[model samples]
Target: MSARLATGALVNALVRRAGSAGGFATVLAKGDATAGAVLIVAQDRGENPRLLERGIGPTGDVELIAVGPDGDAQAIADYWSRRRRNDPDLWVVELDIAQAERFAAETMLGD
Candidate 1:
């Protein structure tokens, strides 16, 4: 599958995982013909955040990642690194659907 498709699939998996956390997951997707796309997930304090990582905000935290038909892994990493450097706490996760599935399964194990 194409990178865009892969990314989209990963984002969908994340949304699903988030939703399973008792309505504590929120996703924001935006795109333009030229600008490409991005997926953002806000996960509130719940088993989900604890599953992913503890110490996240109770109100939730933002997970931003680029999506769609442009940019390679390095580009995506650099883009976020350059712009989001001010927010040093940002976590960068690169995954496909299979990886996401494994992540979900592992997280469900409660570390």
Candidate 2:
């Protein structure tokens, strides 16, 4: 299995990458330093909010699971808030970028 990144390192890297690309990112809630699950909120061009999580595809490649749009921002936030309650070790990383899918395709790592 591929090595997983520490939560802090992962957050730092993501923030740096996003800034360099002219997009902005920030952590909504911090989680365990060593083994937190990353739940990304990909916001594209001020519309179409999506919930993203990393997972392995059938082909063994790293895949970003996009949980389609959950209508408005408030609705998605509420959805995630409920989820966060269940998994306290979840990291909420929001990305405001032009193309969220491209960001996922570029960053997610897999074996």
Candidate 3:
């Protein structure tokens, strides 16, 4: 199996990449550095928000899966709050930018 990057490192890289691309990225909740799962809350300048997480796609390759509420901040917050309660080791990140989904997919799958 191919090696995976540490969760902390991946988060750092993603934050930097997003900032460099004129976007805003921040870690909402930090998780285990080595093996935690990551959840991305992506938006276009704070609009059209989507919550994404890496999961096995139909072809068995890793892909970003939409797993939470979109377009409503309160709903998204509630969803993630419930998720964090269940999985304390899940990392939550929010990225606001144009094409936020693309940025998230690239940062996550590229590794």
Residue-level lDDT of model 2, residues 28-86, one tens digit each, is 88777787877888887667788888777778876877763554798778877887899
**lDDT tens digits, residue span 1-111, model 3:** 889999999999999999999999999999889989999988997888889998898899999999978889989989998989999999999999888888888888995
* Ordering by TM-score: 3, 2, 1
lDDT of 1 by residue, 44-71 (tens): 3321211132232445643322232233
Error in Å for residue 22 of model 2: 0.5
Task: Please say which candidate is ahead in TM-score: 1 or 2.
Answer: 2
Q: TM-score, each model?
A: 0.28, 0.86, 0.96
Among all windows of ten consecutive residues in candidate 3, which has the lowest summed lDDT? 102-111
Q: Give the lDDT of residue 30 in candidate 2.
A: 78
lDDT of candidate model 3 versus the reference: 0.91
Error of 1 at 38 (Å): 4.8
lDDT of 2: 0.78
Say which candidate scores most in lDDT: 3
Q: Which residue pairs in candidate 1 collide?
A: none
Ranking by lDDT: 3, 2, 1
